[model samples]
Target chain A: MTTASQLTPRRQATRARLLTAAAEVFAERGFHGASVEDICEPAGFTRGAFYSNFASKDELVIELYAEHAASLRQAIAEVAAQPGLTLPDLLERVVDIWTRDPDERRRWYLLTTEFALHAVRDDDARRAWQRLQSQIRKELGALIESIAARHDLELAVPTSDLVRLLTIVLQGGLGQHLLEPRAVRAGALEREFLPLLVEATTR
Target chain B: MTTASQLTPRRQATRARLLTAAAEVFAERGFHGASVEDICEPAGFTRGAFYSNFASKDELVIELYAEHAASLRQAIAEVAAQPGLTLPDLLERVVDIWTRDPDERRRWYLLTTEFALHAVRDDDARRAWQRLQSQIRKELGALIESIAARHDLELAVPTSDLVRLLTIVLQGGLGQHLLEPRAVRAGALEREFLPLLVEATTR
Candidate 1:
């Protein structure tokens, strides 16, 4: 609930550093392996500082997921706003944004997936993560709606269903790319198949 | 490589029990937590019998993966061979097989995913798993090819790409289903979208 903008400049900087340190530590040591002290030491902040910025490691990860999701959503929205582009073009641009971040993108996904496995068994953690995810689903639904309206196409399925399929494609591509990069190049699966989905599932 | 038929009936029964026990043990305790003894205890076998059938835990998981993949492949292949079924009919049947086998299906996916997390970090483990996966890919490719040929449609992408996309859809549905069952029904994503992929990607 506390936004970075609500904090003073120094606290905001501290929070950013802690998030960065958490990303690195979590990526290397995994969710359960990385302790608060481990994350605090690298961020050059004490436990008190970490507590001030984030309530717990779970909160920190949820924020990271929100940040990652927001950046991707914003990037795609910018592309969608471009005048005269088709739905496929907008999708391709979205894939580009997804794959373009290189190291950070890979690290975020690594941390996200590692945490997802942990969260699946933990009720509070899953609920917190899902809250953010539902917001994401709504935004994506609106985006798909706008694109469909622009193209004058009546969708074969509901907007939410299409969003779910897009979600599946995105996560599917990420999972495959993470496990077998050579087999599934960064964005290759989404790029080739998502457009086909739009074409086949819409009139 | 050793088929059940190659073993004596007693050995085959032992191997099957060990596998079933491994599924339960691994599901309860993950890849590293579950010991060979734990698997053996439930199967009513000693660690010696475990070693005779599987070289190690990794081998056991790979074999489990192989078995699960083979059963699904065989089931889908049977559906494909049914006379006069269209591509959508075959796909629906495939989804049914995936969603059916309720208890075993859920357990196998849980074990497989846990092993996958472990395998992602271990090269020897990954390579062993990939060897079986590449086989699945080939089989899926041929299945897609046959269904397309049956429909007399020219595929927009290569059979292999469609297979990869389908693979993405399956895992995407699975990962979501595992994490949030109410949000993504067992076979909902694959059922609605896979046929759309086939319809749109083939001419």
Candidate 2:
């Protein structure tokens, strides 16, 4: 029998392939439209392999959800930790990740838009999404609280509301982006956005 | 032959019935899940009536979209006209319509949430949504700019961004409302939210 470490490279490659394939399938066919077979086909994997790795399509969705959240949090965390970085810098960086690449951002928007409704219908998926959102709120809230302390701002809205506000703006930008991406792409969305947040917090 | 005024009342009644039925069906079954038949059944109308009044499901959706937009603008117009009304008052009123009827808001949220994606997929629906949103932005922006002028406050963001930002927050709040109507009640949500918007408009 092959040891776990011995198969690490292969496992890593398969996982990456599966995720990439899933994202493509999910974007093109929507969450409900895509099947496990469609996702696996792109990855050159069989249903058995998919099942072995993930219990079901919902499970894969949860995993992908977690990955995207983690990636977002990580980017924010890095910016938050960067030396001498102003709030403007952090905000711009955050917006760039989502708005910089149209194709990537569109795919991300599709996933999020579909998954939100999917979670609503599926109890297990809803729980998973709720957990992910809760965690993000916690993480982001802490970051905001830290920033508030540095800036000496007393927010009228709680850090959680602030997180919700920013998240909504970013998500809603996807709707606007779907309509007029060029308009949003031209300006500094979060750059101009953070000051309002800063002002609200101070008030 | 139906005279313009004579047709107006009948049209209004039919429109009301259609909107009410559509809202109910959309709330229950989502945009894609609910069909024109679902909406027509509750309104006591046949496909002929639906088709006569509206070309397709998208047409019906656009009508509902227009109604909501008109209602919102009317609300804002009333509050905006109130002499010496503080910015906070306007914000409160804006938030109130959303939280006015908890049950109704839940239904509205579900319908509106589904509409965004549907708008993106359907051209006619997308144009309808964009038209309404543009009108909302223009009207809301004018109100915001007026308030800023009267208050002698410098908004950190432009009026368009302010309207877009508020719209997004409202959308997210509605999304939350959909998921946990009882938990995230209107009063609890509006508590700090109003101040946040008002303060953002302040210098």
TM-scores of all predicted structures = 0.89, 0.84
What is the per-residue lDDT of model 2 for residues B1-203, given as tens digits with 9 covering 90 to 100? 12224557888678678778887888788888998898898779998888877778876776676677667777777877789887677767777766777676665666676677766666767677777677768877887787777778877667787777677677777776555445466555555665766676556
lDDT of 1 by residue, A94-171 (tens): 888888876776667667776777667678888877777788789888877887888898888988778877877887
Per-candidate DockQ values are: 0.55, 0.46
Cα lDDT for residue B125, candidate 1: 81
- The residue pairs in collision within model 2 are none
How well does candidate 2 match the true structure in TM-score terms?
A: 0.84
- The regions of model 2 sitting more than 4 angstroms off are A1-13, A145-157, A186-188, B1-8, B42-44, B76-86, B145-157, B180-190
Steric clash pairs (candidate 1): none
The number of clashing residue pairs in model 2 is: 0
Each prediction's RMSD to truth = 2.6, 4.3
